[model samples]
Target chain A: MKITDPRTAATGHRVSLAVSLWLSLSVLLALVLISIAVGKYRIGPGELVTALINRLQGGDGEVPTVIETVIFQIRLPRITAAVLVGAALAAAGATYQSLFRNPLASPDILGVSAGAGLGAAAGIFLSLPVAGIQLLAFAFGSFTVLLVYVISRAVRGHDPVLVLVLAGVVMGTLAGSCISLLKYLADPYDQLPAITFWLLGSLNAVNPADMQVSLLLVGLGLVPLYLLRWRMNLMSLGDEEARALGVNAGRLRLVFIMSATLVTASAVSISGVIGWVGLMIPHIARLLVGPDFARLLPTSMLLGAAYLLGVDDLARTIGEVEIPLGILTAFLGAPFFLWLLAHSRRGWQ
Target chain B: MSIDIAGLAFGYPGHPVGSDVSLSVAPGEVLCLLGPNGSGKTTLFKTTLGLLPPLKGRIAVDGETTERWSRRRTAQHLAYVPQQHDAYFPFTVMEVVLMGRGAYVAAFATPGRHDREVAERTLRELHLLHLRDQVYSQISSGERQLTLIARALTQQPRVLIMDEPTANLDFGNQVLVLNQILRLKQAGITIMMSTHDPGQAFYCADNVAMLRDGRLLCWGPTDEVLTSANLRSVYGVDVAVVEITKTGEHPGKVCVPVMSDPRGRADSEIQAPPA
Candidate 1:
């Protein structure tokens, strides 16, 4: 029997995917350049390149000191943090979504963000320095997921994923309550505002040190995900099917949760509790590239980086006062996400 | 390859669903498991696939104990096709089939060109190459089941364990899947599948195992095991195992339910149709 071949349709899909990837990459590159050039201390493209070249060539002192500092010290670190945090969160979100087999699963679904928020709040209440606060956030974030994992493991004869998610929800709520308690007890004039702002999230305070540390942690997390990208496809099929397909699903899940949590914690540590990017970017990427993790991961990272950088740029330049990134992301992301949901012909399943 | 299950007890930890169950499927033979809901057929299949630890006995593949084998090694010998269900992502048929090559692909690597070739060839064999680019979720239920079968086939396993492959399918699709099962059997692949319908067992199963309440009711060659008495015993409903020997067609068996009054009244108490 002859079947009508849709080979041409398939080829069209392949071509579209390729085009989408290239378009995302180009957008990201353009956003990076725009982010570098359009800051308050507006440096022209020529001056920016010259300053970068001068900095790279052993600080030749040809560029003015103020320009050099703005490019290298302030804007560069903040931009790098934006991209890294964006990519990390999006990657983590995609991982969790796939692992949970739920489109609604986000980077913080496992309580990492809540734990980080609690840790940062505690740090601000204690009047700790920025570095100390970041450290606490990272530590607490990892600890929360570990605690949830242990709790899920302790509960037997239930669906493991459901158990894990439930534990995370419970733990996340507890962490949120703790943060609220901290907020209630803090000195309203100083610590409360600091805690609130930290919770709202910002990249304005990101320094070279924070950028480097997060970069390292995010890279560490992403390597395992990249290596096991193919296997990640089977993970959504659930533990039983994955095992039947020769993947040790339990072990693979552990590896994935740890990796995704590491990236999320690291991103949250430096950037505070930026929301929506993790939850939204992966969906947008899936709409663009379909759900093949090998393609989805990279596409998510690129789009996420571009998205946050663009949002951050707006945060700085859209008004006299810089808006918290969390607010901007929600304000922008929710509507776009809804629009995507309504317009896309593909079902979320 | 052949599979041997000796005194196998299986279930999740702290909950034993079935125990002391034993069965085997020889090379290229089809073994059909017939059971009602919650009778532990799925649990048994999971145990046989090594997804769950056999609580009491052992499962041997090709006469070798598979207790210590890695999941990859187990999958090299066997693959599983789960019931038709919604996939979370809209992966294309080709992508889903390519995932079956996970056992052969390196942990740190994606499926290579050769893996794609195997997936494509499996799809071709199943006549599913035409739907290769179609999203798995968008396909008809029968096509989804076939796609899953193609995935299992791409694993290049000698044995395939399917959990109710015909469940939820319409009549034509059910026959299509059954015909595919027979085709696979003819291709010398061992298949162990569970079915809600005993007639399905009659259709393709060389051997049959009837399960109820976590225990085997009867098991042997299909004709010997799937009698009307066995069906009534297992399902608590009377059914006549009828043979149809239509001319110019292969003889087949079908289970026709013998309905009774729902009020527990004897047939004689009901007003009979005017003679």
Candidate 2:
């Protein structure tokens, strides 16, 4: 009867987890199905289902070519890319916030995005192929994080987290300057547009191959993060307390940083530099399901996937030309952030 | 399990904090470390808990060298209650307590049913079962301290180390925590805690160790080691050890600091009470 009864508290967590999971998963599935029908020529739900069924059944070439092209080619890869990028960034953001004990921390706090941006810029300037550019971007992003880790480890004074953040900022600045130099040297008519588009972050050109690769990397990174979900709660208590509770804070931190960077790099390689999804989605998920990582992880993943998919749909249909995902995310995210600030007392734990 | 330290030296790199500290706490014994601020009490506690590697000499838990033991093994034998518990996330009291089962659980596995039962029983034993669902950050300082203690109890350790458990607590909470310590001692849990109050040493300690400027002033039974001379030498003050006898209670020893030195009057200007 009483709240403090162990049975009540235990079930309270389980119930909230189950309820939020089902609700978010339902919303996510509905959004995915609805988004498939929301392009320039909107397809009805029934038509969309029929097209999917025909495709699955080894089409006898009876399906309309326009319908087949639009559903399978135009929308499927873009929608899948949106969901993967959103989920990856959101999961990475949650891990960073917990690992650093700072709510302000994001996926890019370790300079993965900046390094990836530089790698993309240099790849474009060097005139690398598409696959080569993505590969280079991932490598540079991971390399930058490794350098930051090593520098922070070598430093003797200051808190470890502070040092890591400082190193990231310094490395980020260096990488940013290099990117600017590449832009200055690039041909304004040809390479400049490509660089700008990539930096602004868009899903306009995502293909099946890119989606498959990014999804594989994102899924690989999520395994460790999911397995370490319970320990992630301990990370928020700061290193000393975490260590006192029998955790090797240093090792766990390294594991989390590597996992988060892996997913963030993979996402950026596919979708350029979509921001705010990482920062805003976790906070929103925290509001819905409290801050326990066991519940927060899945909730954030689903909410992020749905939120970005909706935003992408709006980007393509809002006006004549497609708006960049980075721009729309900021426009939507800033207002939501203000609302969060106004209602932070709801539950900021 | 008991803690054994012999000729231990603890400090940061190029900064030696304390040395030659030799002491031991038997099973079921409570050892109160008394010292002024910055006297290396925290450093000693960290060394004993195996957080800081001893600069010299050997430290052991139950006669096993700490260096040979894994962090998890050391945690299994000992638990630490820090001076402050601050977490940014809003974990429930039950969740915070459940973290004590971390060492027992495998790296990739979550805590199981038995682990949760142990956590719940520990919370109930510490009278925190009623507050299990409350947010840890929303709880009072006293409740947070008790929650941390319950967490340590969940570890099922042989020795518990507390760093200033009563620091910042009000009168009632202070007494409440002291009684908890006594109860734990009765249940055969060895405790080693540091405190700023010498009187607290008299109340809960079976033995006492006093440190001043990285050196031990005295170490022995509480009554023999916490006398006026040793107290004055360790704290640089005049203190009288007095026994207060109640009508139907055991006599209790208290350290009364004598602050009547005339030199202290020059800056003793008093403010008049409001009308």
Q: What is candidate 1's CAPRI-style docking category based on DockQ?
A: medium
Model 1 over residues B41-83: C-alpha lDDT tens digits? 9999998888888999999999998889999999988999998
Fnat of candidates, each listed: 0.84, 0.52
Clashes of 1: 0
TM-score of each: 0.94, 0.94
Residue pairs clashing, model 1: none
Worst 10 residues of 1 chain A by lDDT: A6-15
**Reference-based lDDT, each prediction:** 0.90, 0.87
- What candidate 2 gets wrong by more than 4 Å, as runs, is A1-15, A345-347, B260-275
Model 2: per-residue Cα lDDT over A1-349, one tens digit each: 6454343443253348788889988988898898889879889888887888888899877778888999889898899999999999999998898889777788999999999999999899999999888998899999999999999999974678899999999998999999999999999999988998898899988899888889999999999999999999877888877777788989999999999999999999988988899998998787678788888899989888998999999999999999999999999988877888787764244
Q: DockQ (Cα-based) per candidate? A: 0.62, 0.46
